[model samples]
Target: MSSAQGGSGEREESRPKDVEAEPAEAAAETSAPVAQETSETPAAAPETPTEEPTPADEPGQAAVTEPPAAMEQAAAPEPAPASEDPAPPPRAQPPNPDGEAKPQRTFTPDFLTELFRNPLDPGYADAAARKAAGNGAVGVPKKILSGVSALTLVALGFLLVVAYQQTVADEPARTQARDTLIEQVQSRRENTTDLSARADQLRSEVARLREQQLGGAALAELQEAEAQTGLAPARGPGTRVTVGDGPSPIDPVTGERSTEGRVRDTDLQRATNALWAGGAEAVAINGQRLTATSTIRQAGEAILVDFRPVTSPYQIVAIGPDALQREFRDGVTGKFFRALNSQFGMSFDVARIGDVTVEAATEPNLRQASPSPQASVRPTSSPSEGGR
Candidate 1:
């Protein structure tokens, strides 16, 4: 009976051992399935150990035996060797204790940590150089790549500087070409106007000779025509008139005023009319004479007389008898000038241009009027030229 009771105690202890072994066997079976699931999931879900109890944590002899037995029933040993060969190298067992080797801890000094903290230090460089020496061909390509990148950047910068200089060198020639074009356009416009005026003057002279003396001697005929039609050359003593305006008015939006300002066309016309009534025979504006066909145009801040730009301080010269100049200086026209100065703050000056040449205003370019009376009788040609 005592042996029976001793056997019963042994059986009870074995039953608890068996219970622990069962869990270990179950864990071994489950681990393969769990690891497979971990591999299938995304890289974010790695095989980290959970906080729950595992058979591996129960480090007893009975628990240790369970995996070998479970694995033996599930798969053959030799078949697993190919997969286990790679896995065991990464997780090599540490040295055993109690007559087994104590683990030799290799003090690696956390080389990665040192590399991050002392990236630019010579000490780190020496270690990296040693590692690179061991790596051989792998490190040589990296050095060559860095050197090539630096050389490429330098070449690009030099090309940019050369291109910029070439562009700057071309600018002056372009500006000179633009100025030449503008000058040629202005010269052509002036020449065209002068030619038209000459043709008209020749036609007027021919008409006069035919009118007075149909068959008189040429010299006698010329004198007769000149006296009859007031065709004598225009010549007289003249007064000179200069006109200018007040300073520019304030700009309402910008609140700024211009310093160099001048008179308007209306103001200039008023002064010209005053001189005409004062018995002036011929009037000239900015060296251009007034004629029946003369046009005064304003462009921006300048006045254009026959396309010639004239600005502030305009000079107007007129030719007539000397009696007209003296009379105009103190006559009703003189009062008009004073009133304009007082009312609008305009400026004016009058002077006598002695022996001034007031050439006859070129005869206007006449579009053939009634084909001139001489059209049927006189010799026909392209067109006659004259100096007016």
Candidate 2:
């Protein structure tokens, strides 16, 4: 029984030793396969100059040595043949933790040389040299620039054509609008003239009816009123005066024709006043009868007589006694006419006519006048005067 116990103890101690030896054997097996693989591969064969030293015959030595050999094999990759394989392209570095890529650097010998060159040196010579050498890198390609310019010009031309077409399309509407406005103005003028003629005819008819109702005295009164109010045409012996614009004068500074010497409203007014002062009974200017309310004025470049435009040569017809021509020739009008002729080179002519006719005046609008009730009432006598 004592011998049996001692043998069991010895066997238990040997078991631990066997366990440790098993691990070493496994490591050796793994390393042998790797070494064999390296020898077989042509790429890794050149690096296998000498085999890795095996561990010494000591406990735990194989485990330590095996791990280092494995690490070295992993660290040193096998090199590929230069002739059969292409060089790998440069790999981009990873971005920062913030996800921002780093800026790349560009370096050229010419750029570096220019950066360090002195500013005092002449740069024109270098520019000339570069231009003469016809370096393609100096500027953009001519073909590309020309293509861009052509595209820009084509776009501009297209826009201009579109604008012109739009204007042409709208032309008919614009012309129609202009013609409509002109027609409206002409129609209004014709309507005014027709209404004036109708009013004059009605007045003449009323005067004729009054003449028939109240004979001799009333008829004479009506005739006198018509003459005074310029409602009846006048035909009598009169003096005729004609005035015309002077020739256009040359501007000394601009060498252009000037209208300064032309007849004006003031000149016409002066001539008319002088004729009235010479005891003229009836007067008419440019075929327009002059009444109490008649006005001689200017509208733009035109002369307006009684709100009607008249052109040169203006003719003044006056009916008076046979001595009218003699009186007017010796009056202020004759002197003014002489002055105008000499100063402005205007045309002024006076003639005596045997019989001259003057047209009736435009009807005046009586908007505010009302018949007087007291005027129509007969005068009443007191009781004492009635008894007598």
Candidate 3:
């Protein structure tokens, strides 16, 4: 009862009825109403008599028919296309002149762009519509879901209660222990400070009493011991010797600065030993005085003189006769240091000082004496042995 204008505007006459639809086109038509008769024909076939659709059972009713699928498809409408015959798509337009694929023209924007533009997903709306219509996709029941959620909440609450109880149980003991430790630390610190002050007072008092009580020979002997043992500060003519790290040159092979020239603990130990060999009397290095018990040793990268660290450039002060500097230069110390200077780029300087003061050594050498063998009596031992 309806008519469609031809795409080329030709009369729908003088052509065989090209009534067969493409399988794909038939699928498209199934979802919609049957296509109306086109005013234009498909091809310029010779005119043929038309076979009309069968008439309806009711009188004066218009005949209704569906177009047949292509030769590859069944004559009757199919529930689904068979496996053997697949129909080609119907083309409404001619192919491009250049034979290249046509660029798809879309009115809608990209998916991400649309997602950002509209935050709500279309599927959510469709699901909500299905729910409103009381035909939602089957899943877990609401009652079961709600019961499970309640059980989960109850479990979480039980865990929280247990955790809080455990914390409460431990909190008091931990707090008490921390407070006790703090109090003990504060008390010990105060006690130590008080003891230090008391010790200083006692030391001063003892010194004053010793000066008042000790007379001529005793006083002189004490003074001599103090000077010899480096207990008292020294002031006399001596020599000043300064030794420093050598200059480091880059190595050609490694392309890095060589560490060979750097002053090591062993180097300082050797240098100090040389000074002792050169007859250094009451020597001090970097203000740390040296006694007979004093030691020069290596600790990691440091040089320790009597357990005290000495840094470069090392300053060695020797308190001795006016000839001390000259003797040091004439000794092996001078020749060895000169070799160091020539080979390793080490710096060494010596000067004779008319007056130099050296600080007293901080530590003392403890010694004990025993009675001579001649003084021991044999009478008591002999009596016990004779009786046995």
Q: List CA RMSD, all candidates.
A: 24.6, 30.9, 21.9
Ranking by lDDT: 2, 3, 1
The total of clashing pairs for model 2 equals 0
Residues 232-339 of candidate 2 have per-residue lDDT tens digits of: 777788889889998887889999987766789898888778777777767889888888778999987799998899999999998877787877777777887878
Q: Scored by CA lDDT, what does every candidate get?
A: 0.50, 0.59, 0.55
Tens-place lDDT digits, model 3, residues 1-388: 0111110011111111132122333433342121122112211111110221122211111011111211101211211222323223333333433221211112222445433433433233223323433444448787887899999999999999999999999999999999999999999999988987886677659767887899789988887788767877778888898888887888899999876666676665665676667666678888989888888777876788888888888888888777778877777777877788888988888899888888778645558899766456766665556777
| Best prediction by TM-score | 3
Cα deviation in Å at residue 105, candidate 3?
Answer: 53
The sequence of per-residue lDDT tens digits that candidate 1 reaches over residues 3-37 is 32222122112212223233333443444344333
Candidate 1 residue 158 C-alpha distance from true site, Å:
23
Candidate 1 collision pairs:
237-320
lDDT of 2: 0.59
Give the Cα-based TM-score of candidate 3 against the true structure. 0.50
Per-model TM-score on C-alpha atoms: 0.38, 0.49, 0.50
